[model samples]
Target: MGTLWYGGKVRTLVNEHDIQEAVFVESGIIIDVGSKELLTSKYSKVISNEVNLNGAVLYPGFVDSHLHMIGHGEKLLRLDLSDISSLVDLRETLIQHNRKLGQGEWLIGEGFNENLFNEMIPDKFFLDEILSEQPIVLTRVCRHALVTNSEGLRLAGIDESTLNPPGGVIVKEKGVPTGYLLDKAQDLVKGILPKIDRKYIKRALVTSLDDLYQHGFVGAHTEDLNYYRDPIGTLHTFYEVIDGESRKFRANLLVHHEVAEYIMQDQIEHDYVEKGSIKIFADGALGGRTALLSKPYTDAPSTNGLAIYSPEQLSQIVQKARKFNMPVAIHVIGDLALEYAIQAIEEHPVPSGKRDRLIHLQVTREDLIDRLKKLSVVLDIQPRFVASDFPWVEERLGEERLPYSFAWKRLLNAGLMCSGGSDAPIEPIDPILGIHAAVTRRKPENVGHPGYNSDEKLTLFEAIKLFTLGSAEAISNENKYGLIKAGYTADFTVLSEDLFELAPDEWLNVKVEKTVVDNTVMYERNKD
Candidate 1:
């Protein structure tokens, strides 16, 4: 039996004017798309159900090109310090959260940006004042850096004598440990923390997927192997949760390079879960002044940034992933890191039918773009960073670097394959917000302010394509997804209003009406 969906503007996204009135789907595939009267008459005999769009608009289902599924779920569970603008509120929130925790439980919080804090750069002394007895760990929004109390440092056995690990740093002041861990150094404290149970892992995955569905995301390319510390178990849990029956969601799993070998050996495959690229971190993040840059930061002139892997080491890692017949998705935030990534990828090409990905090209140069256009790689961009990082980020990069930093339009114009994502848990997971940021190129709250680089703003259609066609292409699923044509998957994101008709500033008010995946209505907005 087939289902007929009609009465709304069906944007196929093949072209600007390719809107249709109806779509007939059967067995999770679109059987036909045309005028409502034509589709209804053609599928009248086989049609078992009909969905009325009620004047809402429909577009190809949105897929987040990059995100951490489990981390997003954990963010929902943990103390979210994203909104803490002052050290006083942070201390109070931690105190209140600590009071609710059972005795001896490790107090963990994520999404604290010192840039938002009035005091700036929190150290061990600030956290120790909250609780000297209980171990506390507060991760920066970038997840590349974290701050802990004295107890956490004691538990992790990190002191003034502790040497920084390879590709990591233990921030210190006046020969004393500051309890701030960057990059690989974060593993020290995390290693000692209690192992997460499989049940919690499953819960987090399920919760995150459901939340994504509610936000109109049909699927996401998520990296979570590092979170659970068990690649095989985590992969299995993903299959168990995203099963086509109970939970109808698509997932492209990016295995962390640290556990890529194990996952490649297991060879577990599923219809709904796809084993995608091997994720590697080339450098740290910009917020912590850790994103590796060719030159020193404008504000922090003492150092350039943190590079997680040298050129040779990065090349070796890429070669290793290639040996496993997998593509490498390297995280590169700074221009220097991008150079290293480019070198690594150039040295070891991805396997046939696979595409290497460079996530977060926050900083770049014209020469880098020219080189990138020649490579078989996709740019996984988080447009929302403009809304969040800008104005403050200007201070880090200075006016000279502004032209090349976060230049999505330039990258696209250069004919580079670019996709969109929220980098959720770091930014909000809403594609609408991402689209808004891409189109407006300004903070949603302060729309009147001219965008940091007003010339780089993308059109509404281009922004929408980033989440649809661009994302599908990132996972090599462009043929089966990202369209409303016959034989394509019957996945769609229904919205309360037509985005093209709405002003860019009003996009924040737009609501997701329904999220359909594989012919199933996974989420529907509550009428109440």
Candidate 2:
């Protein structure tokens, strides 16, 4: 017997058609979709269950194309400093959190951004005053940088004698280490932190998945390779959940470039898992002024930015990924980094059908967008970044580069498949917020700017496709996911209000009333 679901406007997202009637599901698959009258005439007798959508709007289940699942889960367990705006509050929060820690345990926290702080850049002085007994490490909101106290530096063996690594920096003052680590340099201190138990990891993953489900996400294309102490163990935990308890949740994992070789050698394979999309950091982030740029930063002219890998090195890495039948999702925020990535990908072409991805694309020129289109690469973009990094971005790139930055519509017009994501933990995981940002190109708060790039704003339909079809293409799951039609997986995101009735400004107000995955009600608001 199958399940008969009705009572909503079901947007199929295929050919822009919608069904006002019913959808029949059986064995985790959408068997049919039509009107209530016809579905009742056909499947009423055989249906075993029914769902009342309560006149809500139904959309194809949303897919977050880029996120760090384990990292988000870990953040849930750590001290969140995202809202800390002053030194006093930061100090108090850390002191309070420190008091709860067991003796000798390292105090770790993330999501502290100096941009939001009253004082621009932070030093370890204040942290040292509050957290002297136990080592404390606080990662900046960007995740590319971190600040540590004296004890953390001592435990990590970092001192004035410690030289900066090739692609990272150990910020120092007056020839002495300031306990701030940037990019790869963070590994030095993080290496000394105790590993999380495997059981806790499983719990974190579950908690994270449940949170995502509540946000209307059916699945996510996440990179969890280095987010945990045991990357393989984390992967195994994901498989255990998928194969055992949480079969409704779908996750497409990307192997970190550092571990692609090991995965390829081990020949690890699972029904829910696909192999060989290595994540490479071509450059750092724009907030830190470390995203490689074609020209020097307008605000900071001392350096263009940091390039994690040379063009040749990137080409060689792509070649290795090609050998392993893996695609590369290179993080390229600045124009220079994008150019290097494009050149490397061009030099070492993957097989004809394989799709490599360019993550971020925070800063780009018309030429780079054209080149990316020609190369058939996927654009994995975070729409929320436009709303979050505006006005501030103007300072980073100046008026000269502003026109070409965050040009999602231009990429779409140029025939590029752009997958949407929240970059969660960095931003909120809500898809409505992401959709709102993409459609309005404005901040949800409606405070600073009306629109960052009014011309680049996507239509509501187009933006939804980015989270659905575009995300499906990013994970190479086009055939199975991204639509709510017959012969498709029975996954849907039910909204509390009709999205079509709402204006662009009201998109953020729409809530996920219910989320169904694989014909099962994974999450339903107000239902236990």
Candidate 3:
């Protein structure tokens, strides 16, 4: 039987003030939407069920344009270090976590940001002083680098004699390995570590789905290929997530070029999964100084970051994806990396309809906005990054690059499509946090610090659309989801309060009252 939902404020978000009070759903599709009296009088006979919203505010479910689902899932079960502000805090946390680990078991932790620490970077020796008996690997918040203890390095066979791998760096000091591996070099230790089981990978995927649902996410464009080295194993984990009975969300899997080939050859498909999307790494992250930049980092003048792949190499990958009518999403953080990505796309043109993406345009030239508009490349941005990186970003990029970095509003004004994401596990998976960051362009609690660029702030409606319509466009599903119009999918996020009515700071405190997909309530705040 079809359902009729009414009795609350419904915002289609086509404009700042487009509101309705009722929506009719049949076969999991919105067939009509309007005022309660209008819809009820129009389709009274067809409706068999009803949901009273009780004054809640309804919006289209959020779509996270870029994130690593498997990693986000796995991190949920790992030692969390995302909030440590000092070395003493880190040491104490690790010492306590180590006590729980069995003898000889590796103690792996993630989400550490060295920028927040009194000491910029923690070396291998720092970890060795606390948990030296067993192996230890602490990943930076960026996930582009990691610091390991001597025992962990020994297990990976890294030493003074080991040369850095292509596209990766082994930070060394006085001809000795410093226990920090950047970018590709992370494989040195990751390859040797005991692999996670397929069962756990599946469990992690399920856990991430539940968590995202609580945050009002119904769909996401996620990359999980690197989580498991075995391509088949990674695919199996994804299949389990989508095909399992508990599955309630949709995911567009952005496969690495390596895994994309396998899936293409095998023709893998699922009801809740969309394939033919390829993911590429143009460079590393800015915080790690691995994101390729045109000029050297102001703080470190000796090196100008690293380019993971040559322009020619990226072009070749793009060409391959084009053959399959797939979209290619490149991770570009610096101007240099963005330039290389543009060059590759130019040399190897994709089909006219496919929308390739430029992820993390944190530092880019304003002049390139026109080129991006012409190429029809969507900008997949993380709004939370502005809140997390500001003030600190000044130290890394300096004043010269400030105008062009995180220029989301500029790009949008220039007629380029920009979608929003959390880059979850890197930031938080909460869509409200992303929205607050986008609208306020400042930290929630810090009112004194000037925004990185206040002029780049988006309006509340503009920010919400980035997670709805803009994200749907990025995934090539704009007409199917992202709106409350008739014929759109019946997926909605019901909030405790009207977002537009709240103060800027109050948006951060907003909670999800319910999450509905296909006219079924997937998450209820009270039950959770």
Tell me the tens digit of each residue's lDDT in model 2 across 327-375. Answer: 8899999999999999988888766677888899988988877787777
Relative to the unseen true structure, what is the C-alpha lDDT of residue 430 in candidate 2, on a scale of 0 to 100?
A: 86
**Best candidate (score: lDDT):** 1
Off by over 4 Å in 3: 448-450
Which portions of model 2 show Cα errors greater than 4 Å? 15-19, 244-246, 266-269, 447-449
Ranking by TM-score: 1, 3, 2
Q: Model 3, 384-450: lDDT tens per residue?
A: 9999988888888999999899988988888888899999889999998899899888888887655
Evaluate candidate 1 by giving its C-alpha RMSD to the native, one decimal: 1.1
Residue 81, model 1: Cα distance from true site in angstroms: 0.3
Sorted by lDDT (best first), the order is: 1, 3, 2
For all predicted structures, in order, the TM-scores are 0.98, 0.96, 0.98
Model 3, residue 180: distance off in Å is 0.9
Screening candidate 3 with a backbone cut-off below 3 angstroms (N, C-alpha, C), the clashing residue pairs are: none
Best by TM-score: 1
